[model samples]
Target: MKKSLICALVIYCFSSVAAYAAENPSVKALLSEMSKASQQLNYQLSYIVINRNTIEPLRYSHAVENNVQLAHLVYLSGPMREIIRRGGEVSYIDSSSEPFTIRANYMVAPTIPLLNSNINELSKYYDFVLLGKAREAGATCQVLRVVSKDGMRYSYVLWVDEKTKLPLRADLVDRDGDILEQFRTISLAVGDGVSKALGELQNVQLPQVLSLPQGNLTHTYWKVSWVPNGFKPEELNRYKLSGTNQMVESQLYSDGLFDFSVYVSDRNDQSLKSQLVRQGRRSLQIYVSGKNEVAVIGDIPPETALRIARSVKFSPVAAKKVADSNAVNNSPETDVAPESSSQ
Candidate 1:
């Protein structure tokens, strides 16, 4: 009887350990699988990006040949726009501009970070949670939620196909749980070999790579007063405006998932009026302060854009003094500097 009791206790303890080991997998594991599937599988995806007021249909195909990755994207509506990716170089073909190529590992598209970014790095700003399972695109999908820890960035709901381990749908949601934009796959086909069309696109002669003008990288005279949580300065450069051809100071910031560009230009007759514009998942906020015009544009909420725009500031002793004086006098309608020698 004593031996039987000891055996029963050991059996119970082993069963408990087995149950714990069989618990649901970690969110990071699921994301890692999705990332691997995106890069390793030969698949074609037809999807639609739905914004607040408009829906744009797009198609994407990815394949690998001789260990080289190739992908293509085409806008199914409106003007002709296409993108082709060969290895690390991406070429843009559009009706509005001449074809150009840029060096990037992944094409600029929704949920691209899942395919190219490290999950551990992104976890610095976002917390991933498994929200259970659902059916999407006629297949079982594991639903996951990515929430910002500080509420400075938007959150996302991702549906990853269980069978293929690929992303099926994603929704960008605001703090209030309102979905600002959504990407849903209408059809998906996976194969063991590259498609004939993808092989031809891989061999097509792409246009010359556009050289981006090098700018002074040491300039630190201007800075943003307030940055959202997890965001860091990516680059600061001076460039000529496309339309006005005026020299402008620009700063880029990113928080792993979202990116925004800030442009500070001398106030001119062509200066954009203070206004807010929302198109699809992007927002543009422009305001004029003294002799400087500030524009903040990104795929962020309008409120967040406005706050960032109001936080642009000048550095150093003299500029700070002038900025403080302006704040005290309340003479300007905006928070940016009246005029800075940095531009």
Candidate 2:
């Protein structure tokens, strides 16, 4: 009996060890390769970013020099939003809204080298898994699943070029298996970095991007009692739409990979009480008659957006002390965990 028990125990131990090793194989290598492809490779790509009702195809060129990444992004089909970023500084030339220059945070989404945090830092919320090979974008591609590590966030899958390790397509999906957005490359080149490819977009003029001035009286800050962990405020500005006397304050928040913008406007037409579902992304704009309204937009689910918006309560003093206002209950200690080699 004792001999049989010992044999079973040994077999179980070996099986457990084998399972763990198999589960983590090449995670570190795959992550490193993906980062190299995004951070160092020189590539010109024509890709598509698709939401449910909207489809946009744009061309992208990137270069890396001395460990600095230079990229130029332009919208191909819509109001031209031209942007150039090197290292941490960003310059924008968008003709859509007032044509003002703004400094974008390095970690904001749709921007590479997201928030200066690499795949390692974001891996806390998601896992990197290698799927079987496939053919895409006129080249062999490897599919990688960035599975959500927690229920608080969404998951993503990327189809990366096998030879270059450049992501040809990225699909963002919710827990219900619905794709929220899809980004894919239509064509690509793998040899040089973005700095070398600068010649391609050399003729394009980038508008002057300046940092936001301090003590802006127009911007208002509403002190929220709670926000989801991993979210941080990045920028704030105020505007009034033409043809109407409505006023609004736009505030952008980011959590390295994901960003959410909250727009505060007047309660004209009860905009907040009625659900606003545009571009297939559900959003909640909370407004009280004559009181300030809030529109929360991000890649998050509608329920999550609603929760955040509903939880917002104005502290009367925040408007005057916008710069000093602190986000409540969502500090890194309570939200983000220590970074370590786990895979």
Name every residue pair that clashes in candidate 1. Answer: none
TM-score of each: 0.81, 0.68
Model 2 agreement with the true structure over 251-289: per-residue lDDT tens digits: 666666666777666566535474655344345444342
lDDT of 2: 0.62
TM-score, candidate number 2:
0.68
lDDT values for all models: 0.78, 0.62
Best by TM-score: 1
Task: Give the C-alpha lDDT of model 1.
Answer: 0.78
Which residue pairs show backbone clashes in model 2? Answer: 42-192, 42-193, 62-194, 63-193, 63-194, 63-195, 64-194, 107-115, 272-285
lDDT tens string, model 1, 1-343? 9999999999999999888656557888888888888888899888898877788899888988778888999999999999999988999899998898998787776533365556777888889999998988798898999888878768889998988988989888888998888889898998854466698886699997777755444443356777677777765675555665465667788776788988876678878788999875688999787777889999778888889888777555544644465457653222333343232
